[model samples]
Target: MGGCVSVSSRSTCSSRSNGERISPSCLWIDMFRRKRSRRTFSDHVTTLQHLSSIPSRIFTNGRSSSACIFTQQGRKGINQDAMIVWEDFMAEDVTFCGVFDGHGPYGHLVARKVRDTLPLKLSSFFDSFGSKQNGSGANCCNGNMKSDVADPVKETSTEDRVESLWREAFLKSYKAMDKELRSHPNLDCFCSGSTAVTVIKQGSNLFMGNIGDSRAILGSKDSNDSMVAIQLTVDLKPDLPREAERIKRCKGRVFALQDEPEVQRVWLPFDDAPGLAMARAFGDFCLKEYGVISIPEFSHRVLSDQDKFVVLASDGVWDVLSNEEVVEIVSSAPTRSSAARILVESAAREWKAKYPTSKMDDCAVVCLFLDGKMDSESDYEEQGFSSATLQSNHSGNVVESDDGQNSEPCLQRNFTVRSSEENDQYRRVPIDADVEDAENGGTEDQNWSGLEGVTRVNSLVQLPRFSEERPRP
Candidate 1:
């Protein structure tokens, strides 16, 4: 497998001391001589100072323009899994980063495609949501402070609607990519899948969405003055009850690896699609038929001033360092980029120490540091309405034929609206397992205050909601 990567890395130096004023010819002559010495130097340094005397616009990012990506090919004995860091310091108010960890063959292509497309999909969704607002009232996504109580129901409805639209758009994008893969003469014979973890920063709030086992962590300045890693998303492993049920429905079972000498082998069952351990993922088209869904889990939170940095990494790095260990290492580092690189390099070193004669697996990590400046979290709290219900089934939208199979149809229908209090805490437990099946119930409508228009479909695997009543250290 081959990897195609384009990366740009930049470092800006801010110094307080001013050098003694020098002659223009001395600087010009030195610059000319340096240019003659190195051909590549001509492409390096495109700072405004070199181009013209006009002043450069100061960006809100607190740094000059910078971008970088790193790509590598693993040794012949190992999988050529390429990892990347596509950081652009100039984006300001929006720090975008993602981790793509691939397995099987041509993992590099999977990594490259994820890095290029995922962020664009998210940004486009945001754009669509923002464009709906008249922009004159309290609807301002540009972070300008405006006063007015927002409608929580409307906001929730808008958010849910946009989220569902984006989810469909994401699927469409993947389907288009699949079409391209089938048509391309060069990409045939590549059977691979990758896990993606993408994080986007809007002011002080961070939104992280992930698929598979890749992870993202938020490190906060703890009470002891040391940084503590606060995890955002849950790892989608085969152990979860919901996941176990899904796998079992697919005629596959997860087995505990016993210490027995004769049964020491750890492997997925023969009937399992792709013979992979992960229960949920993207690009493993072979498993889609059996309900091995690729729905992503997301976490949205406000980062306080006490927050230090974020770490997004592949399983290769996590296999070595725990969250606490990662916090310790990142806290000691001077910059987020260095911490990210160190994490990957550290994992490689650990692998070498454990196996003296073997090459390590491909590893990658990306970290974004909070530069001690305060950005109001409220400025980034997305306020909108979303009306996407959990099930795709509704009255006339999808019709059931006389044969009990769904028929293709185009329709719109009114859906039952359940209030937060009325619909709160309804669970369906089957009276008899042989006769009845448990159906998803409801809980208190999860809506941000005043944003009542947003109607969120209940997740089957609901996470315990964070509450101010309960202490969360």
Candidate 2:
């Protein structure tokens, strides 16, 4: 499989004595560039300083059959949804992809941290397991056995061990990731947490770990030769029976307000401090004792030839677009690399149209090709999505039908994406305090005094009630 990775990783460097700064997500200076380069230190430093002026506005995610990823921030504000696609993640024939949606104050930071470290931890744990399994008569995955060695482990289908190993790896990696998030000296995980939906692909096997509402879905051709979208995740939302049960058993509250009665959210039992949409996640230490957990739900699958690709995305994409619409857009895109971006752009437009009074959610996605090819024909017009818009169902909830026809009241305006240049003011490195207030289910410029009655972990601040009907500033 060919990978299309466009990102070039830069080395890390200490802060210069001179007054200059870079965005936290931007390129870092290489301290050893002078040593590696035949150039002098003065020349390297000069080059580094010159590059510092450019803000990383675009992420060209893959090398170009490598897993592809693209993210677009919504008009809502700062993007807290962080996603990753790592092809050749460790050993050959392995790829790891994940989407993390952060919420509450400092959520972007939490999502970023998890995106950066979770895969590494999983790899490390797998390495340890492999070492321990070596010479134990466990002969699979090359068995690492030398010809001179006495007994070579028996050969078997790759699927057998790969799935089991990853199940353990996902469980361990999530545990270690949560511990790191909790103990980090600089990070405040008290009221913030990130939902994670991740998948590791090796050959035809896929090992998935989900903790929260971020989802993984597969677009495949079924036995009837008809295209179908299979949802790989049961979105761990508060409304799910098992999820709601666990929340209640652990003394947490799960309910919906009159304004948005269809949507249920998790609240702290004692004071309703953090009202989270998902039941499980990494971080949110404040709600840890009350029912929120960092533990992930694990699932494994064997990919068949009919499988075309898998899409992992945050709720921002799901909130606006239905499963079939998402598959239609991705399958019809001009190229696989652009599919994720197209999905995000469409979702951003829908967010504005459907929830006119509410702020949009940040969108991130990882699109992994199973059949490994991009379709040149992007004629989605015939596919029936071009004319589609958001409409109210019988329940009056905003939803776009799979067939691209609106039966109820619909928003018909074509949405314009907020340009990166126009969004520069909202993109912050260490996010502003007000951004925290806005991200944690508050209306823009929503009064902080309205939340004074609820108890919070870090401070007295409480979350303003999140309502889709509230007008955005």
Writing each residue's lDDT as its tens digit, candidate 1 over 134-184 gives: 234221322242423334454444334433443444454444444444454
What's model 1's overall lDDT?
0.42
lDDT of 2 at 28: 10
Candidate 1 backbone overlaps, count: 34
Structural similarity to truth (TM-score) of each candidate: 0.54, 0.65
Best by lDDT: 2
Give model 1's TM-score versus the native structure: 0.54
CA lDDT of every candidate: 0.42, 0.59
Best by TM-score: 2
Q: Write the per-residue lDDT of candidate 2 for residues 187-295, one digit (tens) a residue.
A: 7777778899988876556788988877888999988987788777656666555566778999998875333334456777767556566688898887787777887
Deviation in angstroms for 200 in model 1? Answer: 1.0
